[model samples]
Target: MEISSQIPWSTIAAVISWYSSNIGVLLLNKYLLTNYGFAYPVFLTLCHMTACSVLSYIAVSVMDVVPFQSIQSRTQLVKICGLSVVFCFSVVCGNISLKYIPVSFNQAIGATTPFFTAVFAYLVSRKREAWITYGTLVPVVAGVIIATGGEPSFHLFGFLICVSATAARAFKSVLQGILLSSEGEKLNSMNLLMYMAPIAMVVLLPAAILMEDKVIWITIEIARNDIRVVWLLLFSSSLAFFVNLTNFLVTKHTSPLTLQVLGNAKGAVAVGVSILVFKNPVSVVGMMGYGLTVIGVILYTETKKRYRL
Candidate 1:
């Protein structure tokens, strides 16, 4: 399918917007976690959730981006709660992964998300893709394996959490597609976020309090000592809010597969930026690995498009 012929300019704009926020948040959060010494992943995630909640409220109840709709059915409420669990799990794990690993390595692991997504999708829906499409995923998996050998900083625990994070993210997307596609319970991104943000916030609070509240107090003192920390954090939170906006916009305009493909491409961009900004060393082998992953991503996009998988 020739996407250009069918997708409206509005959709293209949304894709660009999502890309910007996704990339921006990755870089910003990494800076905060690694360089700036703001080591509160769960709490930081809560901040993002809180900001998204506030912004979503303003967008809906105040601005009327999409009319506020309440969840009336117990069934729908159950579904959203289930999604919230996965969503919160994925996001927290992601933040935790980034905290312990280099941004490039973190994103390299993340590039494998589509494979997990495909697996979860097939398992959940029992819908099969063409064998060729399945074949295309091999390169994606291979690339991640190759990259692992060359990772400059590989923490085993961090890598494990990141893997779980990737899987959870895939699960969330698959569930979102299944649960939200129903017309009767359908919600635009803002409305979806409005409900989801609160649930995620609730789910994350105990974790934040238990795991981070004590350790995070140190960061509070540090922030007080250096006011720039506060400014940077607030900036990060603001960007985090916009990320939800762009995330919904892209999914509204495109398929989860498209978003997955774009996310893979964004990983390459993120790794390049992280290396330049952080002055991190990338060996020849590592460069080759990164290149392989990106090539696989490109191939996957083409195969998915041509086969309409």
Candidate 2:
């Protein structure tokens, strides 16, 4: 196969793990919110971030998969916190969006993140993508627009929050590269995560308190009544950690470009799994739009790769 020939077996493993973790966590979150009636997106995200911090800490401090180092400067600390705030917002919005929209539509909306990233890069960084790269985004945007129009499960508020989450994610990516890409400051995945998790918790605590804390007592009782719910939450949280770990591995082995290309397929995979698992309705026209978006993503990846951007 072309993939077996081109990608190392280890990289293939990483990619598989990445997809599994992403899809698994998403399905679990959907179940928690919809099936279990745990209506606390911010709190759930806080729990996942807590789990990630514990996992990263164990890897760095105990297993020594990555070395533990303290971030020294206030400026650097502020930057990490800033990134965390954006990350927390994006993730929480993503979860909330899922509460109101089907996973397939949510993932489809997320497929537009790259387009927003390019738009932001153009506006804020004055970076010029290749014309083809720019051209390819046309279909990406158009497909999302088409898909949005036809999506049977579309909710305007959910759509807006999902769009906001996608934009926040793009902004987070750009800001991270601009602020934290320095070799002297760079921490590997585990260590960077070690710092980011607590910061996200700190940043998220207030929001969770403001939004979800009102029902906190009742949700706690429900979680206690159902031990399986607790376990599922823990499982989803652990999968969240694996998602980042495997994403790092794949990106390290293959290029970020390869990971991006792989991610385009991930959208379709998530959609397919959601349909099979959740029995969410999808029209032929909607799928055509999703297919257009995936094709656009491939074209966009090729454009960026061809120009070495």
Identify the leading candidate in terms of TM-score. Answer: 2
Worst-scoring 10-residue span by lDDT in model 1: 300-309
Candidate lDDT scores, in order, read 0.82, 0.87
Error of 2 at 256 (Å): 2.2
Q: Model 1, stretches more than 4 Å misplaced?
A: 1-17, 213-219, 250-262, 306-309
Clashing pairs in 2: none
lDDT of 1 by residue, 1-309 (tens): 788888898998887877777778888898888887788899888888988888899988999877788886999998999999998999889998888877888887777776898899889998667677778788778877887787777788888999999899989989989987888898777888889999999998889889876756776788778988778878778888788888777877788777867777677787888888877777777667767777777776677667754
Query: What is the Cα-based lDDT of residue 50 in candidate 1?
Result: 85
Clashes of 2: 0
Q: Candidate 1: which pairs clash?
A: none
| Model 2 lDDT tens row, 1-309 | 587897688888988999999999999899888877888889889889999999989988999866688897899898989888898889999999989999998988899888989988878788788887899999998998889888998899999999999999999888887878787777677788889998898877788888876656766787678778678878989999998888878878887776787898898999999899989888887888888888888888888878754
